[model samples]
Target: MITIAKPGLLTSVQDLGRYGYQKFGVITSGVMDPVAHRVANLLVGNDEKEATLELTLLGPDMEFSEDTLISICGGNLSPTIDGKSVKLWRSVWVKAGSRLRFGGCKTGCRAYLAVAGGFEVPEVMNSKSTYIRAGIGGFNGKALQNEDELEIGTPSELSANISKILADQIEDKKFAEMQWTISSEFTVSSASKPDVRVMKGRQYDWFTTDSQMKLFTEPFEVTSQSDRMGYRLKGPELSLEEEQEMLSEAVSFGTIQVPSEGNPIVLLADRQTTGGYPKIGQIATVDLSIMAQLKPGDTVQFVEVSHKVAQQLYLDREKKIHQLKQGISLKIRK
Candidate 1:
């Protein structure tokens, strides 16, 4: 069990997100950084889709009522246990009644916390994620608050065995008392404020040749209006070859929509189900995670990629995740 002593900024519950309900107008509300969220779970031996807390620019302060294992990943928020600093992207065991806190982040915008057996939040519409716009899912369908009590679920056999191994490995370290570092193969270094790759959309021909060239060559800064729904980009205005009204259609995550104003808006995880603005391009799935971490005033560029290449990259990332899980299992047995 855990108690939220200070729910920093906007901490909320998130999982892989709700799917299959987009037809009914429900948006997929999940962790902004899916890779980091999954890594946190993997370190604690939780299922890949298990629910966990997603901490934003600031993080929460909490106290564990019982001894349990937890893994922190994503961003570079310096975290500490009982006033002693600990490392990220690793699993650490906290004794009963110990306090855990996180300082401000230095790199990315969000962090993930995967507790043993996950966070034990109730699932809504087949997901435990918090969709604040609709007031559905997560803890009472909203962000956690100070003094809120959270229940822990039953741990898997894998988690139980891993905890024992971790406990023995760090018995000598003062700060990391019973912590074990779990290395992640997916490096975010290349992702830091990266240029997102995009594929031309159905309305690609609407833009003038010069406008298209500028889009690929120029850098755009994220506007303050950007949020989980979409990122508004500010750069050279783009003019269309022909003025036309676009009919509403399905818009997926990373869809870069260009409105009449000429500025581009990149749809994100909590975007609307449909949009009428013309889409100029779509960011690849893998890179969308990097896009989600961008803050206002951050600069980014767009690169073009073939659909076949994008598909291959997606498959390769999945393969890497599978390999990492297998490696962890082998290490546990050794």
Candidate 2:
């Protein structure tokens, strides 16, 4: 068990997401950076779909009641155990009674912390992810706060073995980390502005040619109004060639919708099921992780890519993740 001493800006439990209920107007609330979430889980020998703590700009201060194995990935919130700095993206064995805390952000906007065993949260609609607005899942259907205690699920066989190996290395230290890490190539740098790639949306041609060109050329800053729901960009005001009323349609993650105001709103993990805005572009799946790392005031430029190429990029990324899992499994066997 772990107890929250201080709840940072916004901390919550999230898995991959909730699905199959969108038709009922349910939103899919999940981790913003799936790459980090998945990798963190893999490091701790947990399934990628297992629930993890998604720490926002800030993080939580907590105490572990029992020996625990953990991994931190995504944005660098600068986590420490018992005042000693710990490494991210690597598995670490933490002693019982250790105080885990995070400092000011150094890089990305959010981070994912995964334990040997996933968080034991009640599942809602077959998902443990929290959608706070509807209060559906996660720990009591809301963000974590002070005095909150979270129970850990039973560790898997692989997690037990990994824990045993790490514990032996810790010796007298509060925690110990593995020697190797996932290649940095698989990660997007939070310090750098990312060029998000997109494909033509279903309503791509509805916008004027000038608006379309401006989208790919002009830089857009993520407004402070942005949240898990969607990012409201501040840049050129895009207008359609002719004003026409359209029926609401399904909108997916990374859908770039332009409203009457002309500013583009990029739908995210917690976006509405459907939208009436004109969607001029759809961010590529391969670049969604990069977009997720972006924070308010961050500038981004869009680059167009063919859907075929985007699909290939996604395939390559999946292959890389598969290889990473195999390598980690071999290490555990050894």
Q: What are the per-residue Cα lDDT tens digits for candidate 2 across 1-334?
A: 9999999999999999999999999998998889999999999999989999999988899999999999999989999998899998999999999999999888888999999889998999999999999987999999998999999999988899889888889879999898888899666586455799999988889999999899899989999999999999999889999998879999998999999989999999999999998899999987888888888989998999988998999999999999999999999999
Off by over 4 Å in 2: none
lDDT of 1 by residue, 1-334 (tens): 8999999988999999899999999999888888889888888889989998988878999998987888888876778887888778877777778888999777777788998898777899999999998899999889999998989999887788878876776555432333345554564443535778888887988999988888888888899998778999999998789999889999988999899999999998789999999888899887887788787888888889877888899999899888878877777677
Q: After superposition, how far is residue 232 of candidate 2 from its true place, in Å?
A: 0.7
Which lDDT value does model 2 have at 268?
A: 94
Question: Residue 80: error of model 1 in Å?
Answer: 1.5
Give candidate 1 misplaced runs (Cα > 4 Å): 170-185, 190-193
Clashes of each: 0, 0
Structure candidate 2, residue pairs in collision: none
Winning candidate number (lDDT): 2
Report, for every candidate in turn, its global Cα lDDT versus the true structure.
Answer: 0.84, 0.92
TM-score of each: 0.94, 0.98
